[model samples]
Target: MRQGLGTQLRHLIDLLDGAVSAAYDEAGIDYRPRYTPVMRALEGGQPHTVSQIAEAAGITQPAATQTVALMIKEGLLESSPGVRDARQKVVRLSARGRDLLPQLHLCWQATRAAADSLDGDLPYPLSEALAAAIAALQHQPFGARIRKARAAITKETS
Candidate 1:
C-alpha cells in the first residue's frame, strides 16, 4: 500500500531530524532544532519582544513564548520587561548562550552544507518544494481545502 502524504512527510522529518540531532550530539552541543529559529532571531545580541522574535522566526507567538521560557530555564536566554511596554517581555541571549554560539554556528554551517549536498542530489530541491507548499497554503489554507473536500463527500454520500 502507498503511504499517505502525512506519513511520508513525517518520515522525511524523522530522517532529517535524526541526522541533525546526531550532528549536534557529535559536536557536543546541547541544542534542539526547535531552538534554532529562536536563536537565529536573537543571534545578533539584540533584545527583542516575543512578538518580534516570533515574526522573525516565522513561528507563532505562543511557540516563541514557550521556547523562550524553556531557554530561560536552561540558562540560555535572558528575559526582561520591555522598556516601553512593561507588559511585553523582551529577551536576548544569556552569557551562557553567547558562549555556546561559536560551537553552534560551526554546527549550523556544517548542517547547511550537508543540506545543500542533499538538495543537489534530489530531482527537485526540497527547499523549493517547501517554499511552493508554503505559498500555496498561504493562498488557500489546508483547513479550507479539507472543508471543501468534506462538503463534496457529504453531498455525494447523501
Candidate 2:
C-alpha cells in the first residue's frame, strides 16, 4: 500500500526533528525543537502575554499556553501578572534559559548549515516547497478541499 500525503509529511517532520534532537544530545544541550519558537520570542527580552507569544511564535494560543506551562515547570521560563491587566499573565525567559542561549545559538548556526547542505543535495529545497505549500493553503485550505469532495460524494450518492 502507498503512504498517504499526511503520513509522508509527518514522517519527514519526525525524521528532521529526530536529527536535530540527536545533534542537541551530542552537544549536551537540553532543548527540544518545539521550544525554539517560544524561546526565540522571549529572546528579544520583552515580557509578553500568552496571546502575544502565540502571535510571535506563529503558534496557537493554547499551544503557547501549554508550552509556557511546561517551560515554567522546567525552570526555562517565568510568568507574572500583567502590569496593566491583573487578570492576564506575561512570560519571560528565566535565568536558566538565558544561560543556555549561547550554546543554543551555536547549535542553531550548525543546524542551519546542515540544513543548507541537505537542501543543496536535494532535487528541490524542502524549505521552498514548504513555503509554497503554506502559501497555497492560505488561498485554499485543506478543510475547504475536503468539504468540496464531501459535497461531490453526497451529490453522487443522491
Candidate 3:
C-alpha cells in the first residue's frame, strides 16, 4: 500500500511536469525550470531580495544569484537600486516577464485540464479514494510546503 501510494505520488508529479513543459512549449515560451521559484516569489510579493528568492525556491543563494542574473540579462527581471543599503537590491519582474503572464496562464489551464482528464479515467470509488489520500498527504508538513509552492504558481498566473 505504501509503495503504491509512493508510486502514485511520483507519477502525479511526473504528469504535472510533463503537462507544464508541453504547455510552455506550445506557448512559444523559452521555459527555464528554475524560473518557477522566482515567479512564485514575485507572486507572493514584489521586489524580492536575492535571499528571499533563494528561500522561497528552496535553493542555495549562489544558485539563486545565478538564476536571477540570467533572468536579469534576459530582461525578464530588473533590480532596483538599494535604498537602505547600497549593496542590497530589490528585484521585480520586467516588462517582458509581465507580457509572459498570459502564456503562463494558458499553460496552467492546459495542465489542469490534463489532470482532470486523467482523474476521470479511474473508476469512481478508486478516484475518490485516491483524491482523498492525496488531499490528506498534502496536509502534512512537507506536503504543505508543496501546496504552498503550487499556490504560488497559481498566483503568478493571475
Predictions in order: lDDT: 0.93, 0.93, 0.79
Decreasing lDDT order of the candidates? 2, 1, 3
Give candidate 1's total backbone clashes. 0
Model 3: per-residue Cα lDDT at residue 28: 89
- Each candidate: RMSD: 1.2, 1.4, 12.0
Model 3, poorest ten-residue lDDT window?
Answer: 122-131
> Candidate 2 vs. truth: CA RMSD?
1.4
Tens digits of per-residue lDDT for model 3, 8-43:
778977876876777687778987756777876776
Error of 3 at 47 (Å): 0.6
Better of 1 and 2 by lDDT: 2
Over the stretch 1-158, how does candidate 1's per-residue lDDT look in tens digits? 99998999999999999899999998888888788899999999899999999999999999998999999999999998889889989899999999999999998999899989988999999889999999999999999999999999999999
Please report how far candidate 2 places residue 22 from its true position, in Å. 1.1
Best by TM-score: 1
Give the per-residue Cα lDDT of candidate 3 at 7. 92
Off by over 4 Å in 1: none
Which sections of candidate 3 miss by over 4 Å?
Answer: 1-19, 112-158
How many clashes does each candidate structure show, in the order listed?
A: 0, 0, 0
> 2 or 3, which is superior by lDDT?
2
Estimate the TM-score of every prediction.
Answer: 0.94, 0.93, 0.57
Tens digit of per-residue lDDT, candidate 2, span 27-135: 9987888898999999988999999999999999999999999999999999999999989999999999999999999988998999999999999998899899999
